[model samples]
Each structure stands twice: as structure tokens, then as C-alpha cells.
Target: MDGVILNVVTWSDMYYLDTWGRRQFMILGAVVMSICMLIVGMLSRTEGRPAYDPTLYKVNFDFANIVSAGTAVLALRYLYVASFAIS
Candidate 1:
């Protein structure tokens, strides 16, 4: 996902830079990446959380905080890579 996003962004980034300029893209990427990373970081600080209910619960991502957090982190990671690559 990281590689793919990076590669895809790289191809179009030149156009974006040409059209919008690097300063704006850099700032946009920086802001997006910072927000993403901050969310992921906050999520990481919370560990050992139960994903299921105390009753009639099964181990699953659907009921777990990790599901959202993990997804957020994965998304953030991709954004981070893309932003880094773009700049």
C-alpha cells in the first residue's frame, strides 16, 4: 500500500507541483501527514484494549478499537510515505 501510494503520487505529483506549486503541496502534505500521524500516535498509546464485549463476545476487529486504530495507522503510513515522496 505504501509503495503503491508512493509510486502513484510520484507520477502525478509533478503535475500537481507544476499546477499548484511545491509550497502548497508540501504544506498540504505536511498538514495531512501530521494529522494522520497524530491520530495514529494517540491510538498507539492505548494498548491492551478489548475489541469485544464482555458478554457473548468473540475476537474480531469489528468490535475492537484496534480495528479503527489499525486502519488509521495503515492509512497514515501510506500518507506519510506519499507525502515524503512528494516532497
Candidate 2:
């Protein structure tokens, strides 16, 4: 059972890295940004006092940047694998 699970996970990870990993990361970033924007907008719309902080935007941007960088690294690794396989 453990072996089977490990095999499945390995296959899934390979497939994701080769195919959809970068796209998925991009989608995740967009979703995170959208959610952050929505939260800030809602907070700003609240009565009297402003609840949104600039730090929140900075934090969200930093998180997305990290994800993008990681995704880029993975994509480069995938390209290297492809090149090695072709050679």
C-alpha cells in the first residue's frame, strides 16, 4: 500500500512538473491577488474608519513573488530535464 501510494505521488508530481505546474502556480497567484484585493476593497468600504493597511498589500505581493520565483525555478528544471532527455 505504501509503495503504491508513493508510486502514485511520484507519477503525479512528474506529470504536474512536466505539464501544468507553472500554469497552476500562475493561477494560484492570480487567485491570491484577487482575494487580497477583494479583502482590501471590502475593508476600505467599511464605515468611518479605514481597516486596510498598506502592509497587507505588500505582504500579498511578496507572497505572490515568492511563488512566481519558485514556479520559474521549477519550469527551468523541467526544461533541463527535457534537454537531457533529448540529448
Candidate 3:
């Protein structure tokens, strides 16, 4: 979930940078990311789980799967770009 959100934000930032400029994209990305972090932090804290207990927290397999998939896609993208650039 977080990874998906981050990917969306990243793509949105790229679009903004292309359409508006670097300054606007930087500001927008910073603000959006900060808000997301804050929301996640608050939600985690409100779950009432002890900090020392790993088992108390619910495991989000969906989030993990999405993150892994996103990572693989990004890695492939980088490899393609690098290969093309080298040629």
C-alpha cells in the first residue's frame, strides 16, 4: 500500500516537473510525502500495540507484495535505460 502510494506520488512528481518546473515539483513532493508519513505514523501509534512486541502488529502481506513488485519494475526500468544509454 505504501509502496503503491509512493510510486503514484513519484509519477505525479515527474509529471509536475515536466509540466510546471523543478521548484513546484520539489515543493509538492515534499509536502505530500510529509503528510503521508505523518498519517502513517499516527495510524501506527493509534493501533495500541506495544513497541517491543513484533507479533502484536498485523502483517500486511499485500503491502509487502506491492512493494516487491514495484521494486522489480523499477529495477527493470533502470536496467533498460542503462542498456540503451550504453548502446
Candidate 4:
């Protein structure tokens, strides 16, 4: 799921840079997204209480962690692209 989001954002940034030639916004968006992902990862890592009806809930895979990982990769790629664009 997070992979999908990062892919979309990356494509969007590339598209914006190609069409509008706005590398500033592209870099800005990528950095903001990276920070948001880091925050999400930190929050997810912390222990949390179960839902009110604990019995109704079940354990599942950590999608947030997966997303954060994907976002980190995307952030690196974005930085690379931004560097080329700015230079």
C-alpha cells in the first residue's frame, strides 16, 4: 500500500518537473513526504493500547512499516532526481 503511494508521488513529482519545470515544488513535496513518513514510522513503533473491543480486533502485518521503507526509498530517488534537475 505504501509502495503504491510513494510510486504515485514519485511519478507525480517527475511529471510536475517535466511539465511545469518546478523542481522547487518537487523537492519540497518529496522532503515533506519523507518527514511525514518518518513521523508515521516513529508513531507506529511506539506501543499502543488495543481497541476498545480488544477481542474484536486481530493482529496483522505492519503496513505502516512497509510504507515507511518504501517512502525512504522514494525519498532517495527523489533527491537524486532533484539534484539533476537543479544542476
Q: Say which candidate scores most in lDDT.
A: 1
lDDT of 3 by residue, 21-62 (tens): 666555654565455455454544543232354686644322
Model 4, residue 71: C-alpha shift (Å): 20
Tens digits of per-residue lDDT for model 2 on 1-87? 344544554555565665665566456545654554455444334321333457765322122324544454344444433333222
Estimate the overall C-alpha local distance difference test score of candidate 3. Answer: 0.46
Which of the two candidates, 2 or 3, achieves a greater TM-score against the reference?
Answer: 3
**lDDT per residue, candidate 1, 1-87, as tens digits?**
777888898998887688878788888878877887787666666642536655866643331545766777677788788887787
Q: What TM-score goes with each of the models? A: 0.67, 0.32, 0.42, 0.34
Clashes of each: 1, 0, 0, 0
In candidate 2, list every pair of residues with a backbone clash: none
Q: Which parts of model 4 are misplaced by more than 4 Å? A: 1-21, 49-87
Poorest lDDT segment (10 consecutive residues) of candidate 2? 57-66
On the 0 to 100 scale, the lDDT of residue 2 in model 4 is 49
Clashing residue pairs in candidate 4 are none
RMSD of each: 7.8, 14.6, 11.6, 10.9
**Residue 12 error for model 4, in Å?**
15
- Global lDDT scores for all candidate models: 0.72, 0.45, 0.46, 0.53
